[model samples]
Target: MTTNDEARGEHDAPSSRDPQDTDADEYRTTDQHEATSPIDRRDYLRTVGAVGVLGVMGGLAGSATGSAAAQADWETEADRRIAEHRQGSLEVEVVDETGQPVPNADVDVEMAEHDYGFGYVLSANLLLNETEPGHPYRETLKEDFNIVWFGNYHKWRFFEENQEIADQATAWAKDNGLDIRGHVCLWANVDAWAVPGDVVDAMGVDHQSGESGADLDPQHVRDRSFEHVREIIEHYADFEYEGTEYGSVIEEWEVMNEVVHVPGMIRAVNGVPGEQESDDLDPVTAPVLAEWYDHARDVAPEDVGLATNDYNTMEGSLEYARSAYERQIEFLAENGSLDYAGIQSHFGDRDSAVSPEETLDVLDRYAQHGVRLRVTEYDATGDDWSDEEKADFFHDYLKTVFSHDATDAFLVAGGSDAHHWRDDAPFFYEDWTPKPAYHVYQDLVFDEWWTEASGTTDDSGTYATDAFLGVHEVTITVGGESTTEQVSVTDASGTTDLVVTPGTSTSDCEEQGGVQVGEHCARDPDDDSLYEDVNGDGQTTHGDVNALFENLDSDDIQGNADAFDFDGNGRIGFSDVISLLRDI
Candidate 1:
């Protein structure tokens, strides 16, 4: 199972291990590790076939098939040594498809609570202004920084006017190994002033049925939605956007934006349909939404992520929308149109305080129905809160979200250090140094979450072992702001690395008491000398040589003496020797 010695993409190295590589280091710190348990390196990097750069890597591995037996023999011994090296590391255990613990399995790690799915909104729109190379704001986007929103069509008009912004955002995202969710390919309430002539032209057909002059054809909306989603996803996938210099291609797409709020906004804009000021506010229905999702899926790339969005998920009449969401999930599951669920968390109001337990319950319900939940548009705001409170609140909320078993991913709602908007509060000061709110996210969210493998490349942009095994947490930062995610190693290697993402509190893992840096983020703690209490004094100390000597014949022979004994056990230990001899 040993991986062939092949060239890895320069950007695909383990997080934080190699600071010299700009692309890989962009999302990872110079030192951090994934906290997942170690796995067989041979199996970790063994590539069969893939669809992108990895596909070429697989071909290269295939060329060395003739020497496969020799490599396997080498790997067999190496795997045993590695396993022996890592014995007891902190782990966030997740069940596999077989319902068995894949102990020491390689996993992807993130600072956030969940993976990318329903209930998460990855918002970004600041991408428009920062495209230039020399702009002072350019450096602000360290990595995975982009501004995408639900309603951009109103602002951009089309690709011609917004091309530069879109181009820069796409380029930066691809280069930095970031992913952007295509927000809302179709929104029903078209801003009258922003509506293109094509939309107006299409609306004429429905006018013949006396559906009112302002009423546009829902079918036309469907067609336009599909076309736009298809174009956007394919556009990002194309070499042009990917810097492939050919076409643009994006793997993830939010099919629509805030449909739950659409009704309220539509009513406010034009009154209820058939009423004195009614326009087409009452025209959209559940079935229409299903159609929109279906069309969006049809037009999206095979790997593209699609979702539906809403705000104030915890309470309000909008809480009723959960049923609507349920129906949406059922419809998509039945029709094979749904891939991810979008839950918008606009916490600042009374609704933002939803407990982690409650959120998990909701997510679990959805997961049971075969839906993956992603928290989209998460922001905490309140009129009476102080800067410190806001920060604390933000951290508290993230803690709840990350602790949930059902959530797969979560995304923030603004840009890199964007100004915070609320009824009344001073969240972001003039200099844009983060408010206590900003630091709340910094301590818990940013760090490296990838482990090392056979190739020279790091994990700047590809889904690694954890993700492939369904153990990844996809996090998105909003408000033009970025957050760092400290990754912990979870495998056999005792090394670590750091990975940075957006809008995440560096405290997420800290709250759990861990950090992932380079090669050994997921190493087994039992094997380290630091976790061993050489003196058997209950507390680790330098005065335990005899104690270390006393346990020479005992079974607990692992980890470092002073450094490895994370838990006090007397002995230089067998596990200690194992850890010292460990290698990636």
Candidate 2:
């Protein structure tokens, strides 16, 4: 039996070295010396083709073909790891409403969502304010991602002013069946950009250099920090909107961001008695940072996760940063305050991109700290590479990240170039049209990793198959009748027994021969005038045309192509919206 360590090491010898067997410096630089470059487009395609992303049901097509053979082996091993870690056996037992086993029922299982988080950063303003582009953005977010974090709105400076923005965004996310991860309760950087200007002044720290002043009071700084943490966590824990409590939708919160890179809070609390030349110049004790976690844990909900987020530990060659981050993780683990160790994977240019093997190696080193791992902020940027190259690299990177057992979530920094911090660093163009990378995301998250299995139940009325862990919709057809139930396949040993009565699972649209329009089902597909009620209003008016125009490229319209394909091209487009407008 291969363990996670052995599985991670199958690719190369350098990644196989156990950190306990080697000194700190040796382990940190084990694979750091390799000349990492952007993935070759042709090579990447060849590698993926050689072995499917998950490799759950196949072997090498051919044997012993030199470098191709080696690549194939690597991919197979990666897929093996993914299957072992990400998938679980799902057994569905079908029974009638009377609690009797139904014999020979046809069962179909389709995955509804992934247990692992695949998410991206979102702009609260874009999600709440814009109409022309906002509708598509929100639709794409709901369709493509299961989790989200605000780009800037959740920060102290931004949240202080526009608390309603975060509230509304959280409400929207809950309504759309999406999860929210709070970006940060506190950023250790004492700059006005991260903290409020008045708070910076009160801390008496230099905004530019993070140096302490004569008025610096350690207790005051700690008090202010603790207050902010309490306020942020408590407000979100029971977030109330309209008449519902949506705060529980936010499942995780970053207690501190960039702890190692921006150690101002750490220095302030420790009373480091010197003018710090650089943020990394002096190493403060890990317990000083762990205190922040302890305070957050005191105020945060028990189920909500509290994390320590930092960058450069996984991607860059900053040995000091890596060592410091590990120290913090170790201390937090010992104190039982850290729920997750967040790695911000911001890759730039081809030369700086970390290889797949190296990524596993870094993750292995940190996994020893015994904390859940997450790729909190991931983005790759290169001015010289073509869109195809970027997409290829993203595909490989996402696959590597998802295959690891220690990593639980992978969140891209941005989804569209228009809202991204860096130009050309997202999956879509400015107009929300998909780039090659966006298709890669869809193919993996929705196709390769998604589970769809069907079979006829035996006399015992049970059908079983290995499925990816997530929520799956099960449909059982027996006696010329069909019933559907949603089941969660959470673990390998779990059996989700569902009892259904036939003819009870039919949706309104199925019974009426109508189609889903937005959140409502169209009542009359044959009535041309009623079909024009795109907004679900009683009359066909200009508002319906506006609704169609706003959601031109949205998934709601595209998924209902049969009803919205007015131009007869078998797809939804501006021409269809124009036709609807003309009719109205």
Candidate 3:
């Protein structure tokens, strides 16, 4: 147990250094040819910004590397890079409280954050631990958290595997104080050809002349979809899994998975190509989404939140930024299915990873709707990055997640390294021993952040201390006649003190947006302001700079003059206009 000294002053929260400021900046690789050279694969990885999340549905089965735009510049660039390859590297410097290097002392540190709960996706083996009396995995699971995303317990697993596991797992979570979020009701039709292949195939309605399929009726498919919702909610809601009345164990459901990229969905259903518009709600996409939401809400009991989960929402992909976030917010706002915005955060090895500030901005964007947010399926991926780098990224990502009030939960997509979906998962190697990320998780969750401490009275007859903000149980022992007090530690300005009447028995407490439809929130779109693409040519070029100059001082600006306001002078004058050109 890592304990803080009550007499001493408070230490800095977890990481003293910025997540981006690691000392591994100058290192260059000499063994460039050592990386297995795949020309096309390497290129596609770079081209499609975040390919790591595409395989989210496949579990350990990997996903394809290509994007919707088939083979193009990504391939050409990869061809160039693969001609002379260089392996990327990652490193982490472990230091002690005194600012000296610590050489491997088997450290287990924990720092607690806010009400935003941390959880993991329970693999089948991990789920099996629910029945175990005292297994190591079970102990670890319970020790860290009681919640889990029941891995592969979807419609397919419901048919193929023993239903006992689902029952027992859910019962265990309820029996324990964990909240369960059921993954999805409808995965993309392209993703539905697995064990529950028959079920998914049966729901297929041919879009031959905007009518139902010859094999399956549209009404029948709709009925089955509704029934599927009813069954899942009812089974978990009313039935007991392991001889325990498992009432209301499931707190939320991800009504639909990734409909944002389902091919020809908008064209076939709504009479508009999915790629044609910047709009999320066209005629076709709207009804299907509405049905899923209606079915889930009608079947589920009250207070059970419904969310439409998707990937690349916060991965900073331009396509997703246009197609996914803005449109989903508009639709959810209309339907009230906006209980939680589920953004899957995953990393690809070849591309640059997302920053903490970028992710927080995404959170702020979604919080504009007043909907709770969850880091739905999270994995810090990439074989190119060292284990330490992954840990560092996870550390920073989580720090931002916990600090935000709008966030409700942050759940990892997999449990163990051996059972992860992508090869570039939490850790590189396959061993049960905890990795650096694991240790970071522990140190943050248990040691530094958790609220639990006890010490004898100081010379001042008081224990002056600080801790995380939460409802806490404090005790004062005066010669075996222990007096316990219930207190809430929530002082925003500084350390909150808990005191007694006679003397100062002080306990310290640690202190811790609107959405736009097509454009950036709060940005006036009379001009194309965000990308500095003033010319509307889809590319930022010299043309844009010329367009800015031509339209200067005139009320009728040619493009988004505001985006080119580089000098922050609040106007598109020469200084601001020329600055964007020079920077470009």
TM-score of every candidate: 0.50, 0.72, 0.57
Show model 3 residue runs off by greater than 4 Å: 1-114, 129-134, 155-162, 189-195, 203-216, 263-285, 319-323, 350-352, 427-429, 452-471, 483-584
Q: Tens digits of per-residue lDDT for model 1 on 463-577?
A: 2332111122322233434232223233334422223223223254234232222111212234442433332212222212223323434443332234443223444433332
Candidate 2 per-residue lDDT over residues 1-584, each given as its tens digit:
12111111001123333322221110121111112232232344455542453342123232212245555666687788888888888666776646577778898988877889998776666566543333556666777788887766677766776777778777777656567888878774442255665555445565532224345566767788788888888897666677553334467888887766566666666664222444443433446566778888888877888887876777645576678888878877888987888887766555546667777888888889888898887766667556665666666678888989888899876635555555454576665565766657766777778888999887887788888887676777888776655555566445434444444322644465545554433334346533565543233544455456556677767776776765566666555654564454
Best to worst by TM-score, what's the order?
2, 3, 1
Tens digit per residue, CA lDDT, model 3, 146-191 = 3577655543324234466556666555544456787756553322
TM-score between model 3 and native: 0.57
Which of 2 and 3 is ahead in TM-score? 2
Give me the candidate number with maximum TM-score.
Answer: 2
lDDT of 1 at 352: 38
- 1 or 3, greater by lDDT: 3
Q: Pick the candidate with the highest lDDT.
A: 2
TM-score of 2: 0.72
The CA lDDT at 577 in model 3 is 48
The segments of candidate 1 whose C-alpha lies over 4 angstroms from its true place after superposition are: 1-140, 143-161, 191-219, 239-243, 246-248, 263-285, 315-318, 350-352, 416-427, 447-584
Candidate 1 lDDT at 58 equals 28
> In order, what lDDT does every prediction score?
0.38, 0.63, 0.47
